[model samples]
Target: MDWQKNLLIAAIIAVLFMLVIRWNDFQESLPAANAPVSSAQQTDFNASSDAATAGDIPSLPGTTQAVPVANSTSTNVIKVVTDSLVIEIDPQGGDIVHVALPRHYDALNTPDVPFVLLDNRDHHTYVAQSGLIGANGTDSAAGRPLFTSAQTEYRLADGENQLNVDLVFQQGQTTITKRFVFTRNEYLVNVDYLIDNRSDSVWSGNLYGQIKRDSQSFHKVSALEMNPFLGAAITTNDENYKKLTFKDLNESEFRTVKQGGWVAMVQHYFVSAWVPDANQENNYHLRRIGNQDIYLLGFTGPRVEVAAGSTGSLSTSFYAGPKDTERLAEISRYLDLTVDYGWLWWIAKPLFWLLKFIHSFVNNWGLAIIGLTLVVKAVFFHLSATSYRSMARMRKLAPKLADLKERYGDDRQKMSQEMMKLYKTEKVNPLGGCLPILVQMPVFLALYWTLMESVELRHSPFFLWITDLSVKDPYFVLPLIMGLTMWLQMKLNPTPPDPMQARIMQLMPVVFTFLFLWFPAGLVLYWVTNNTLGILQQWYITRQIEKADTTA
Candidate 1:
């Protein structure tokens, strides 16, 4: 019975882990929509020529535009350095060509190369582009405006909290000021379009912010690890977070009008989002560029009228950085949803709060995880105690059950009836331990995701040899120890009479150890701590049961 219960638990966990790993495959196999983009759609987003007129611009808003002004490796990049970020802005389309986090390294050991989020490299193209798109606007024509910047390089000065990089586009008396405002220690940058209508009665146009990216994975994961989602997501009136895949873009164009919302490109650990004015009515759209794997997620704001001899402005903040839940929440509503914890967010949120609180005192993330696990176990102590007591009673009835089995021989029905009689006489519930473990599965899964998705745990050190909690242990120590404790827990329960069940019970720990060897060290730590606690409680309960039997 004990062997069967342990086998079942092991099987359930393995199935769940595999299901999560294959989730993306399931999504990719879904059928495409009827109106998939044709070759004609690719021409709509073709690269604009240098000599271009307004006719080249598409009538539809939020259309994907090729980077026609400059190609990758061109000497036309404007680099700006802030306290927390290194950015490269291209004047051709006034696009953010490159963004790197100076505070975070690309890998655990590589301290020199920062994590590059957005770049215009030959192999990859992920840039944030924004400009005016109407009468007298910068990008109103098919040809992107080649604005001139005052300086090619700018760095945040000492004690400076704000920096501005202004690209000026002037045609006679009409001037369009494309200003990029960056703040110290913040990832949000203000992209503003200032329209100075000097020789006009009323200049009418719309401002657009878009992120263009090729289908490329930012981080390459191992076989056992699940790749983070790489696609577009938007917040709408009905749904808090709606994921728009590349396939979805190819199938058909999507447009939604909302008073306040956001459009974003998400990846593992990091996200880049456009948060517009909450009171402004904006149209959000997604589309694919022809057969090329290029996709765009963007927003077009309401038309603005810049009166004669007056200056008008439309602005939105672009957040490009790590998916810090607190920081993203401060930027916009439901923005923290980018740090996806799956359908278990309700449990993961509180679990994160507890882990964060514990880390405040312990000053070590590994210790904080251990502390949180202990607290969770303590909260369910009584329920677990009842389960252990029932198991102990069952173990005490093993001799009688064995006698019934011998008497019934091949008669399975009579054996089951005798076993039920003995169970009723002793008031022992066979499924008590299993029910308690099942109840705790959601908590376990939530905590697992919390450990996996938390960027704070990335490259964090625990103790000797456990340098990075976000990655697998180099020596596979924690997982091996976890396997040992699981085996010890099995030993505390009554041995199964069935040889096949006993063999399965003997092998489950080994199977789990192999699976966990590639798992993150932080997750393995949580499991190891949990299994050790369970073994201690079960050992104590078994001792108490034997003492009672000897007294009787």
Candidate 2:
């Protein structure tokens, strides 16, 4: 009779689950809204140009082989190759036109083609641009200097650990030499402007660094999918990390004053940032560039006055690479915040640290996730022990509880009273299993986000069949195993007196299995490991309680 009741309840819940799934599918089938429209930037660069009286200062040259007004033809590109990076610079304004990471690829299976971080081709305008602005500077309202380099190609030779690409622009008696210094195994490039004020008059100006990007997603995401942030981020005096969306920049401009901070454009797994000298006061700005979908995040350095016949250099570091928190933290304060662990950062950070430590020894990310789950289970062992023991005691008294319920079958109020009295006398809590789960839910969610968002696990593989931990299990093996363990854990607990409650319990494993089928394999592996461990502990405690009861 109880089995009949359970079957009825299961059937009803299954119908409800099907309805929910259908509703989600229907919603996803709908058309998406239009993309954010472009708008013109409303900046006061003209006023600044007028005040500095450097309106004749040269603006940056176009990197996409844009025709110049002077010749309407010539274009120059300088190529630089290093151990880990390949970059292209346009001498027109000394802008970094293209950057590709040799160690990373464009896709999971594409090894020959490297991952490109910056480019100015195929209608995609993403590049790093910087130059001195204000008085006596090359960047001005009038024009931008087109620099001349000795060669068009340079490479980091064998046995060499550093390389320098220099471009120079001479205007009247003043000479501006822009040097881009690259190290063998580093993504941070030293972009320095050495201004030789050979002229009798003093030279004065400010340096500006900016990242310009259009509104095209580098990695395509579905409309109903949950995607990582793709926008502008800045470190401020008030907050460690602040995000300004492309839509936000389009609506209004953003400006702030900070002595030390960074302005960056962040995407799914990579970021490009302009980190100024910490000792200098800089003004940070975020705005959409003139009626296009392009947006700019940049900083203006403090005004500098170089004495006549003296050379003064203004330098800043630009990092364009993967979001490796450990390396980013060394570059600037709060730069690691770009990793973005969400509101659960406190829990996620420690979990990631422990996970990484485990991987150091095991040398496998999948095993590291299992080790992490075991550690979390051990930490909550005492609370879980208490909860499981309570449930075990209740399970031991299930026959008596069933007898009581049968005696008061027609009297609902009286049955409840008797159940409470029985729970008090036996010192058993029917709801004990819920509290520990509630306590650990946040930790579980944190670990999920940690695994899903960490780029280190982007294409990491485990044992057979699990190729990418950051995406779903290819054959649904892990999720099915997780569901099986969950069902076993349920078997060790007392059966619910209510047919509806029992039915819901039975359906939970199936529901969870369906939901986790799309979750990352790493996350599902954690769940399966945790559930298996819990089942073992609960089964052991249940057996011990039954033995003691029989002996007593």
Candidate 3:
């Protein structure tokens, strides 16, 4: 085999190795692994609401006005209402997303609510930790203090309606500006931080804040988790992501996952909270980038720290909206950060760029997927052609391989080596049949992740009987046709010569068909289309080879 083909096959094996490693990571991170739990973060916070200062934030009718603090320094006030959030940001340093918890939440339906009720005293905010981490590690105000700094200073805007808080850490030499955005819709309030360092030395810290929920029953789930392996693990923690809703896994036995970049999408029906990053020392979630598990998309990127006397900015866009993909995608890529394309981002990203481009032209994601698929097939045609020709040649030489094998049955390895020598001398590559398929796997998986995790395909349809492309293929039609196409292509070209291997290869179509039966319709569509295209190419190659053989 040529070096290029050899490298490609070797690379594919490496990729598969990575995939197997990723698959096993969950088990290793499971609590039974007995890894050490990471320690809690150490950072101090002094927060003051803008309600006592520049009260520009609009508030919902039911929202309570900001209760005054002894000495707060902030100049913004915001009110949150049902279906609306108010956010205020200072150009240089800080910003806030105002939240309003509806007064009549009890009147609404809730599957689970906590038994313990802890709302920090009316005027004071509390301390909470979230982001990619363990459940207990996520600990949102579990009766902990809302704010951490020992001493506090409060500055109210001249208008008396707005308040500004200047939180200074004696040891850290930093002051953070936190403001309360109020919502009349509910008791929930958004606290935003504009943290800065005035110290001569570099001040590095994360934004520490908290939300005090009265309910103890808060659990997490995500719109991005489409894999059964992941869903199985989370099921133990009480999840209802897709088809396998509320099916329990062995989460209690697992305890807290200790891997870093630990994120969990806690969903209780309509409401969901996110933990984007967790303390990795004790946290145990599989990695974010390499694994590209849907749950960890937003959990990606590095644990950032600011330079000496320099300000680093990071923002989280909280969605108080419904779980609808269309609604969620409308929030920004940041909000849909759970949509991961895996390692094929090189392919997936460009594909997304193309999909978005096609979407711009046609305004339909289904059509966009088709358009994107065609473009990809076209781009890969060069490599595909090489593979097609190799498969055709293999079929042509199959009789010769049988003759050689029968002539050298006593030494299988020697027979295979001589067969390969014959193949090389004849300018035929047996690997050519497999290399293209291997080459395409990364792109295929990237697209799978794209379609599986993307809100663009969520609930989007492509013609009849396939309403939600993000969900399982409803009628099993696409997968069956996919299998049929693959079978036809297999017949048109060639398979492994070993009887068992050939039989296994013959059954591959059926295996994949059954496997894809429950996959998203979009993925099935892509595979079916891919197989149909391959069938056409294989038939053409076969015809050309037959004519050449006859002429020769």
Backbone N/Cα/C clashes per model: 1, 6, 66
For each of the candidates, the C-alpha root-mean-square deviation to the true structure, in angstroms, is 5.7, 7.3, 15.1
Model 3, runs deviating above 4 Å? 1-208, 211-338
Better of 1 and 2 by TM-score: 1
Q: Whole-model Cα lDDT per candidate? A: 0.79, 0.79, 0.45
Give the clashing pairs for model 1.
42-290
TM-score of candidate 1 against the unseen true structure: 0.90
TM-score of each model, in listed order: 0.90, 0.85, 0.52
Worst 10 residues of 1 by lDDT: 48-57
Candidate 3 lDDT (Cα, whole model)? 0.45
For model 3, how does the per-residue alpha-carbon lDDT over 1-552 read when each residue is reduced to its tens digit?
234334644664575464333333121112211133343311111112222122211111234322222233234432222323222222112222222223213211331322111122222221122221112111122211123322232323333444333322223455544444333322223444444655676543333221212111222212322322222111112321211111222122122332222222332222223332333222222211111111111222233455557555433323332234344344332333333344565677666667778889987777777778788899888899889899888887888878776888678777877788888888997778777878787887878766755645654667777766767766778878888987888787765556655666677677677667766788778777777777787788778878988999
Which should have the higher lDDT, number 2 or number 3?
2
Q: After superposition, how far is residue 63 of candidate 2 from its true place, in Å?
A: 27
